[model samples]
Target: MKTNTTTVNGIDTQALLGAIEAIRNNPAEAQSKWHVTSHWKGGTRSETKVKSSQLGNQTIAKDFTIGIDEPLELCGTNQFANPQEYLMAALNACMIVGYTALTALEGIELEELRIETEGEIDIQGFLGLDPSVKPGYDHLRYTVHLKGDGTPEQFERIHRTVMATSPNYFNVANAVPLKSKLVLESPATV
Candidate 1:
C-alpha cells in the first residue's frame, strides 16, 4: 500500500513544516540547553556522558557516552577519537542536518554528501612550554562533496545556508562565551 506521507531526501517535510509552525507560534519552545559531563580517566584520557537537556522549561533525558583519547605521542593510548575529532564531528553533523533540512524544504534530493575537516594545533601552549603559544587550533578547513539533481547554484545556496544556519558551524566560526565554575571536593565527599 502507498502512503501519502510527504518526504523529501528522507526528511518528513510535513512534520518539519508543522514543527516550524509550532516554534514560530511559540518562540519559547525553540529554546534548548544541552548538558554533559566529562571525567578524566587517567593521563590524557577522558570520557563524557550526555545525561539530560532542558528544552523550554522541560527536562529531556538523553543517554549517550563518548570516549576520548589522544595519540601515543601526546601521551594517550589512542583508544578512541580525540576532542578535536569530536568537535569536527559535531560541526559536520550539524551541517548535515542543515543540508538535509534545507534541501528537503527546497525539494532537492541528495544522493551523496560528505564533509571532511582538518585543523592544526600547537602543543607548546598545552604543555606550557611557551608563553606566546596558543593552545587551540589555528583554524579548521573543510570541504563538502555533494552530488544530486540540484543545480550548481542550488548547491551553492545550500552551502551558504548551512554555513549561516548550522549551530556548530556558528559555534566554531565565532568565539562563544563559556561560564565555568570550579568545585573542590575532599576525598570523603563521595
Candidate 2:
C-alpha cells in the first residue's frame, strides 16, 4: 500500500518536515518544553505502585496498586502482563491525551475517544527456551476511536501530531540514548 502525506490547515508538507527536522537536530532551541517525573515501588504483584507529577498550574498525581491474585485472563488484574504491557499502556494513554489536546487546541470538539493497544511478545528468551531470541515485544498495534466532525485529512493531521509529539510514543518508536549507573553503600568498619 502507498503511504499518504497531508498537512493540516493548509500547512505545507515541506514546512512541517523542515520544522520537525530542525527540532530533532536542535532540540535545545525548540520552543516547546516538557518536564515530568515518575516513581514506582515494589516488584512482582504484592504491591505495584506508580506516581507521576507534571509541572503546570493544574498539577495532579495518581497512584495505581496491583493486587497479587487479580485475574489476568484478558488485560486485567490477574493476568497482568509483565513489564511490556505496562509500556504499551503508557504509550496508549499518552497518545490519547496528546491527540485530545491537539484537537482541542485546534478548536475541534470531540465527544469521545478510545484507544486499544496490543503488543506481541516472545517469552522463549526470558524462559531460556531459545538462546537466540530477545525478550521483548516483536510487534505492537493500536486502534484509535475518535468521535468528531472532521475530514479524513484532519484526522490524519491530528494522528501525525500525536505520534510526533507524545513523549512515550517517541520513546518507544525512536532510538533514545540511555545510560545506567549502579550505587552501593555499606557501613565502614571502625
Candidate 3:
C-alpha cells in the first residue's frame, strides 16, 4: 500500500510518519543522548560547542557553537548572551519546536507563532549582597502569540502538550538534580 503524504505548517507529514515507523521497528532507536562541551574564556565568558550526539547505535555530527557572557553591569564585556539569557532562549526555542511539531502532527495549519520570555533575578544573591537571596530567576514569564486555523480548544491542547513535553520547559519548571565535580588542573605543558 502507498503511504499518504501531506504538508502541515511546512513540516512533511510523511517524514514524521516514517520516523514513527522507524521507532516502532526498533523502539530502542527512539532513545537519544545529547552532549555539549564548554570552555571558559575570561571574565564570566565561555564558549560551548556541540559536535556529535549518540543516536541509538549511531552517532551524528554537526557544527554548532555559542559564546556566553554577562552584561557590563555584571562585570562582563557584554560580548554575547549571558547564561541566564541563554536559559530563557533555550526554553523559548524548545517550546517553539514542540509547538510547531505537535501542531503539525495534529494536522493544524499555522499562520504565525511567536514566543517572548523574560526572567526576573535578584543580583544580590550572586554578589553576596544578601545571604537570604537566591542566585537564580525568582520568576519567569512567557507570552505566546499564535495565529492559526485551529480552534481555540485545539490550541489549548497543543499548549498543554508543549508544556508537558518540551525538554527545556521541563528543565526549568522542575528542580533537576545536578552533580558537579571539580577537577584541579595541572600546569599546562608547552
What are the per-model C-alpha RMSD values against the true structure? 2.4, 9.3, 3.3
* Winner by lDDT: 1
Q: Kindly list the per-residue Cα lDDT of model 2 for residues 19-82, writing each as its tens digit.
A: 6687788765455334333333333444455454443233446565543322354233554445
lDDT of 1 by residue, 41-71 (tens): 9998998999999877789989999999999
Which candidate has the top score in TM-score? Answer: 1
Which 10 consecutive positions of candidate 3 have the poorest summed lDDT?
Answer: 1-10
> Model 1 compared with the native: what TM-score?
0.92
Would you give me the overall lDDT of model 1? 0.90
Candidates in order have lDDT scores of 0.90, 0.65, 0.88
Locate the minimum summed-lDDT window of 10 residues in model 1. Answer: 1-10
TM-score of candidate 3 against the unseen true structure: 0.91
| Candidate 3, 136-187: lDDT as tens digits | 8877999999998889999999999999989899999999999999999999
* Superposed model 3: Cα runs more than 4 Å off: 1-5
Which residue ranges in model 1 land beyond 4 Å of their true spot?
1-5
Q: How well does candidate 1 match the true structure, expressed as C-alpha RMSD? A: 2.4
Prediction 2 global C-alpha lDDT: 0.65
Model 2, residue 158: what's the lDDT? 96
